[model samples]
Target: MVNELSSTLSFPILIGDIGGTNARFALLTDAFAERREFPVVQTADFPSIDAAIQETVLDKTSVQPRTAILAIAGPIQGDEIPLTNAGWVIRPKTLIGDLGFESVLVINDFEAQALAVASLSAEDREQIGPGAIRPAASRVVLGPGTGLGVAGLLHAQHTWFPVPGEGGHVDMGPRTERDYQIWPYIERLDGRVSGEQLLCGRGIMHIYNAVCAADRKEATLETPADVTSAALAGKDPQAVETVSLFATYLGRLAGDMALLFMARGGVFLAGGISVKILPALKRPEFRIAFEDKAPHSALLATIPTFVVTHPMAALAGLAAFARAPQHFGVATEGRFWRS
Candidate 1:
């Protein structure tokens, strides 16, 4: 299925990485040219995506794009696509008519993240543990931000296929005695605690509050930043424990993905939180937890992990696809729309 949809798209392609909180855009003029990036805009600042594009992209640049390749922070289901954590419901047909584009391709945001994993250079990511990447092996990319996003990249027949899914919502349970204590205080969505419940931006606060509750102490940190700041500063015990436990849980999940995909190429951590918590992730706790799976612990120890350091990794991924769709096996049967 590699390059199945390559012929359907044309340049100059407008690529966007639409997340819950921010929307970033860039224009790809041709296959070999660099992308022309626009200023980042808050998703809430505009009433709709069309308006944001008009004000922030089209109006400012002279280059007119014939197609749009968007990676959104939600599933692409139908004509009306709602962002998972924002108020924007993207109507692709509406965009085609309004913006005079010939095609609009929408995909899950983490698919773009996975694409980034396939395309990023050595300097774009920082190694987290002691494992060498096995060439042409499948890989996993997950990020903890407004929410936890997860995806896998499979390499077959010299093509990279990005597998996008709700891996972040996978079932997460307590293992250690410390986890059992804090698990009770962790927020539950629906009735059970998922990986997202304890691995997102708010998840940091959840861990902090859980730590405070487990110790029968008052929770002082209100936001995820406050907790991370205090933890990084080493001034607050609860905050420090919260970050440590956060790293542990993140490692556990990353390891789970590595095993699930047999991601010998590597497992990448993207999103703002991963970059911010680099120091903590570099510590022994994260790697120890990652390699803790008893039966397959040795296997996990051989799989590398990294933190994606590029600021606009999603955009870079989209640009890579826009530049040469033939290199990626992106399934666009239902996701692709044309005027």
Candidate 2:
């Protein structure tokens, strides 16, 4: 059970941002001290969370942590929490017993992203288009990586609330004539395509292959990087088209999310793909498609969008919460555990 009066975490906190491919860890010695971050390690390299923390953190640092705050790339439920795209399962009870931590708090990865949106500095993000941020209004953050992630940040009662959900799996269908022509060739998950199907890393390759199929040409690009490189270099027309269509679809999704929450604060893009495709997102195609909504086009134009530039955005967010939990209203009824 959660202790409503226990608003502060102990000193020497362990914060982690665990995703499908990589896991990053950091240590906060005290309330005012700066976070000490360690090098990133692949999730596949470690069998479990404790092993990774043992080798990457405990083995290297002498600082012992009293509590842990982890943000994983999946929903937080039960003692055995499994990642959506990764193979490892996190057992919080096991972590406390093995690591000698007093308590553990688990949150959805995108929830951490939303927390970052609330606390990030101006230079931590780069604006993609023209619009002003309404300070007290709600905001949204979504990203494309090993999979898609979406979250909302609501401001109420002088506190920031991070709302996490499986918004990445929302339905997405073709709208443009070009999209219709290429849709048939694009692979489907269970006979239909979700937003992640065409907006993630594999989605890049899917778009490339579909564009090739539509154009009656053999696809030579093997990876998403190859497609993006070719497109950025203007060396392959197919690669260029794939990236353009990707930007358009991403914009459409961003616009939809903005309207859903009435996110006048801003819509932030945070992930490995969003950072890599900064140039593509900055192009006219992204903003144009974002503002193409018929009735709310003007409203969307007034709402800003940004690419989170912080390298360890999730860690920063967790650090923020660790420093001052009272500032953010993160739900921890079932997610918080203590021994």
Over 1-339, each residue of candidate 2 has an lDDT whose tens digit, in order, gives 123514546879999999999999999998899999999999999998889999999999888898999999998889999999899899999998999888889999999999999999999999998999999999999999989999999999998999999998999998989989999999999998999999899999999999999999999999999999999899999999999999999999999999999999999999989998899999999999999998989999999999999999999999998888888888987787788
Report backbone clashes per prediction: 0, 0
- Which 10 consecutive positions of candidate 1 have the poorest summed lDDT? 1-10
Candidate 1, residue 212: how far the Cα is off, in Å? 1.0
Tens digits of per-residue lDDT, candidate 1, 1-339, equal 334457767889999999999999999888899899999999999999999999999999888899999999998898999999999999999999998999999999999999999999999999987999887999999999999999999999999999999999999999999999988889999999999999999899889999999999999778999999899999899999999999999999999999999999999999999999999999999999999988999999999999999999999999998878899989887788899
TM-score of 2: 0.98
Off by over 4 Å in 2: 1-8
**TM-score for candidate 1, residues paired by index:** 0.98
Whole-model lDDT, model 2: 0.92
